[model samples]
Target: MNVLLGLSASNGIGIGKAFVVPESEKRVISSKKIKAEDKPKQLERFERSLAKVTGQIASQLDAVKGDKVQSEIFETYFLMLNDPEFLGDVRKSFEASNHSIEYILNQKTEDYADRLRSSGNAYLSERAEDICDIFGRVLNDLLDFHPFDIEQVPDDAVIIAKSMAPSDTVILSKRRIAGIALTDGGVSSHVGILARNYGIPAVFDIENILDEIKTDALVIVDGTSGEVIESPDGVALSYYQNKITKAKEHADKLKVFRDKPAKSADGESFQLMANIGTVDEARVAMEEGADGIGLFRTEFLFMSEANHAMGAVHSKVAAFSEENQFNAYKRVLETMRGKPVTIRTLDAGGDKIISSLDVQHSSSEEKNPLMGLRAIRLTLANPSLLRTQLRALYRASVFGNLKIMIPLVTSVEQVEEVLAFAEKVRDELKSENIPFDENVPIGVMIETAAAAMISDCLAKVSDFFSIGTNDLTQYTIGVDRENALVAPLYDEFHLAVLRLLHKTIKAAEAEGIPVSVCGEMASRTESVMVLAGMGVRTLSMSPKLITSVKELLSKMSIDELKAISSKRLNSL
Candidate 1:
């Protein structure tokens, strides 16, 4: 047996026959010179191929309708197909080249993908993969060849791929594939996120496994440990089989904690909440027994192509309108059944560039987007957009408990501005005879260094505080979490970040307002202990992590957590 070690992405175990997915990037295309007079016919052929690929994506979208995240991903494929700039470049290339449409299209798309890969931005780099996926689909249509069909993949078979696009992951998820092992992906890649959301076992960064392992070989994927056992002998197979049985038993045990109230051994009660990005995830939060929805990322409402978030600024399709946002927010609030739902306003820009909002910036790249106009800065500049979201939120408030949390709040002035605008929205709704919770609380996200330093001032005006450890660590440590060169330095446990967390929590406590940690740090055991010890009673994270964190909380007393927190603060 040959064992391979890689990064553990999704936690689970799977034993099945290996199915090697074909790599579209390896396709060979030979240039066929075309006459200038035949340019019209060539362009028509390209249009036909584009249409066919678009139809396939639409079908995929129909299959995964309720999954807002997956549906949006497929919609992005539509936008990529209809991207005016890319299409213009293709036309220009066709005019300049004597080669076939396939050759020119491939060359231009590769150039675009290469530029994105070298952009030093993780979000854009992933978009490069999406671009390649779109290109492959179109090329397949043009060449009239279908090498692999995902639906034909055997049920519960382990999928082995060099790399998987978001669309491929969505399709494979429907079949309930046994597991996924990839040579190119990480914990935060789009495919990785999908695998976790779908509750599938996944291992990433398994270099050269595709070359060594053959199709239909018996494979054991231990996603919890990032181990892939190929052609295991009798002993190893028996051992893994036992492990799988125990894992199933452990999962069954976890269900007991699902409906239990979150409390420590010392009788210290806490709120275990879920951070969700879609209405569907809010339902998951309920299923996972989350006390509330801690961080409701509203960007998906705008980022989804169906919402016209990706169209041109003046596209006939409007962006996430007041009605669209209201229905989405109302559904999530109702799903929680009166449980508190903290919804953050549209946090576009930075890594998330909403095409409709920043048409100019999307065309002309920004050198330092993360630190540039983003979050509150971007929304405040576009008052109509921010006001529209506020109107929708307040209109949906009557459905259930709701709190508005503003992202990247660097100043008390910013907090006051949002509060003022929100009041005006409520007033307008009241004048129009619309019902809403007049006392809906507005909160601040302690994500920036400035926000943490001035937390006390912010707490005086804000209703509550939610520490976004991801951005707080990035801003405090002056490191981009996605940059491989500096990722090791982007420590969430850094002394400065912990101190900031403590400071923010203290500030909120002094003001008699609630404080919470809603980041990846909150999902980890050790980090949860430290945060709880630091006076954070509300810990919000992924829905899948809630039960595990609740179980850990139940095992430790308040005193033990305080001691752990003290040691971490003093040493690290």
Candidate 2:
């Protein structure tokens, strides 16, 4: 038995035969010159390949089922497939250099991929692989290369790969994949998010994994410990078999709590909601018995509209249309089916910064975006963006129980300004005799020390308060959660962060306004218990964590949780 250490991208345990998914070999294109007459034929080939790849993605969008993240990953790929800039670049290269279709596409993909690879933004750089995946398909089409058929992968096989793109995850979800092992990929990557959402055991950064293990070899994937065991025998195999049995038993026990309320042993009932980014997630949350949606991040709708908006200078229209925005909001609201849905307006910044949504409509090449223009600051600075979003939210409000919340709001004046602007948009809709919910509740996120301090004032003007513990901890303690060097110092259990949460919740309680903690902290058992002890009854997190949190809540009394929280915090 050989134990290989890797980083856990998702948590679970699985035992299955290894299935090595080999990467598609790139075909060599002719680097030779072409005649002017051949240029037209070569350009035609490019367009045909584009249409073929576009159809492939469209088929996946229709065929893929159950997973929301899978659809989103493909949607991003769809946007890339139709990108006018990408098409124009290929055309220019083909006409100028008189190169073959294969050469032009290969060059264009590599060139754009290089820029994204060197962009320094993980969100952008990680997307470079998706670019490679997209163009790889088209290039394969032009060269008649047989791409890897993921559908034929044996069901219940542990997939090992050198690298896995977001689209690859979409393909995996279509099959009965047991687990995942990657030679090189980050846990913060989009595929990682998909893995967790789908509850697949996954590990990454296992160099030369295919060489270490053979196809059909039995493997044990311990996502909890980030260990992969190859060809286990006797005692080792018995131990893992027992481990898998216990996991199954625990999961079965948890299933019994699915329909139960998230209440402490003493019967202190609480609302457990899900933090979703898409309408499909909303469906899953409802399936998991979620009370409502704690946070619906709207930025996922405009993730890369900047592609066209940035290219508009040459010749392309921005994809930031209000109708598209309204549809996204309407779908989620309708999916929730009268359940409370708290939608956070675009909180794009740091790795999430999209320049097309920017006030100046500029590229996001900032040295430091986390502390710079972002969230409500970006929206407030650009009234047009805010108004567009406000109009969409209002239009969608009539479909369900909608609650609009502002993100990164630090000042009372900012709250006032947002409220005033929302009202103005509401008035415009009314003047036009547009249909909408007239009394939608407006709220603000308490995510900064300043916001926590002035929570009393903000709570008075706001209808409700939701604490974004993730950023609140980051800003209050001066630790960037994304920076690996300083991330170790980023402790959510720190006394300072606890103090801020305590202050914020206390302020909200004084004003008789409901407050929910809609952050990562709400997902963990101990942290959820601690926050509940802090008088936070409404907790929002991933839909996958709903049952686990309920199980933990069922085991302990509210008084015991309060005691544990008090003792734990005083020790700090």
Give the best candidate by TM-score: 1
Candidate 2 on 38-92: residue-level lDDT in tens?
7777777777887788778867766764455666566667777766667887777
TM-score, candidate number 2: 0.87
Per-candidate Cα lDDT values, in order, are 0.85, 0.81
How do the predictions measure up, each by TM-score?
0.93, 0.87
**What's the C-alpha lDDT at position 540 in model 2?**
96
Positional deviation of 292 in candidate 2, in angstroms?
1.9
Clashing pairs in 2: none
Global CA lDDT computed for model 1: 0.85
Model 2 C-alpha RMSD vs. true structure (Å) is: 3.8
